[model samples]
Target: MSYNLHQLHAFTTIVSSGSLGRAAALLNVTQPALSRTIKRLEEDVGASLFERHVKGMQLTDIGAALLPHAQLLLREAENAREEIDAMRGLAKGTIKVGAVGSLAAHFLPLAIDRVLGKWGNLHVEIIEGVWDRLAEGLINYEIDLALSTATNDSDGIVAVPDCRWEDNSFVVAAFGHPLRKKPKLTLADTLTARWAIPPKGTAPYEHMRETFLSRNLDMPDIAVQTRSVTVLKSLVAECSFLSWMPEPMYDSESKAGIMGTLPIPGISAARTLTAFRRRDGILPRPAARLLDELRSLTERGMAMQTTR
Candidate 1:
């Protein structure tokens, strides 16, 4: 009379679909077979699970109480199976990773490589967006983990072990811009320039704006507002717009004659890059290990930097 997982699934399906016939359609089982499973489950509990009416069946109090517990049990089972499969080095599961634009530009592709190298059997998916979308995804269970700068606000997502990463960077512009020729750049110099800005409501963009605010500077009339760092960098190269970015976003265009940087006093523009997941619990091993490799690769990439 003891219930098994299948019985629990059947009962839950009946409650969810509101009728045995509908539940059979949803579960892809014969109506009689599904009805028998529900009957068996109810007998095991020694309680009626549903009361039939004109439209469909309604869960009795015992059934209502069991619903959440049954769902949790099934979820745990799925997680356990994933863990076991991961331990056996068998890949073949889905993980949604949230990546902010700036980091995704440089580090995320490398991180993807490391994930693939380590977990060849697993399929990895990346959800690229700014911090807020990523945070929303994590909260809505749309993403498994997020790589972002602003983990300070969320209580529902857990930051990873050893989550510290840097965001401070030098102000950048095309080569031979007047400030680049100066011995050192001052906060006042920032006012003289047209600046490309990040879209509103993002960590990097907000951090850049905050830097200006902290220095008692007016928001540099955003010469251009864009979500694409690539676009911002291109504008810096081809046109006359200065933008702020973490050093990791720096590249040959930034180093060669195309772009130049000026040292702003007390300006590390320090930002934090962190990984967050469901505060409710741990990731299944496949995702956990993949995440570990990704962070290690990012760490190695960052360690190569000589932080000023």
Candidate 2:
């Protein structure tokens, strides 16, 4: 059975507001009317979406499953309206993007600046996370695009082959750290060094692990493991802890002479970065515009590299 936007809106609003009275006030409708909307939607779905309780409405298993689809439908409807408005010469829209910390640090800001310069009315929303979180954002329609390291396993997302580039990862330390003064460095030299890195099973962690394992060396015992970029940087700069990171993530620090990659022999690795989107549907115009800027940026970067 088909459900209308009104019913879905009422359902989602109630989910957000947590109670019928609050949802009714937010929707500017009587509580009875709001209740009728959910009743009709429940009838169409043939499932009890929410369990009534003294505290608030809680989603049943069926409602939990339906929430993502409902949100996706609402987002697409908004995109359609924006697309038509854009066609009518209204250059206003929002671009939602998710990216890993590395790309978010340098690459994405450049593209976003270019896009906003062309369309001043456009808005951008960005969230930083690892690949798993970015993939979830894409699949749930929370983000129109994802910037992350290239991966072979894409369950519900497709990579944009033209929007890919390479960046190098390196073992880094604070500029004045003792390790920086070492005459010569090797992976084995860092085996006993205090380290701060992303948690195990994350892409950064796995890459760091492989860097050691590939050299027939056991992984170093990490002194601190975290996902927060700020915390990682603080530990590295102020605490003299070493960490593995992509160059872009530490570009500003390196430029400021606060931190620099340790000159370890044969320790750097190049990783391919890619842009991705959902497997289905045309990308919204705003997101597409940002993607174009990203492609241009990548091409310009590659050209500069070739010239060098």
Among the numbered candidates, top lDDT falls to 2
TM-scores for every candidate against the unseen true structure: 0.68, 0.85
lDDT tens string, model 1, 218-287?
A: 7667778887767888887778778887766766565566785666678767776778887765576656
Q: lDDT values of the candidates?
A: 0.73, 0.87
Output the lDDT of residue 59, model 1.
87
Off by over 4 Å in 2: 15-22, 42-67, 85-91, 300-308
User: What is the per-residue lDDT of model 2 for residues 1-308, given as tens digits with 9 covering 90 to 100?
Assistant: 67698899899999999999999999999999999999999999998999999998999999999987787778778899997886677766889999888889888988998999998778999999888888888987889999998887565789998988887888999989887677877789898899999899888988888888889999899999987889999999999999999888888888898997898987887778899999777799899999999999988884124212
In model 1, which range of ten residues has the least summed lDDT? Answer: 299-308
| RMSD to true structure for each model, in Å | 5.2, 3.1
At residue 292, candidate 1 shows an lDDT of: 80
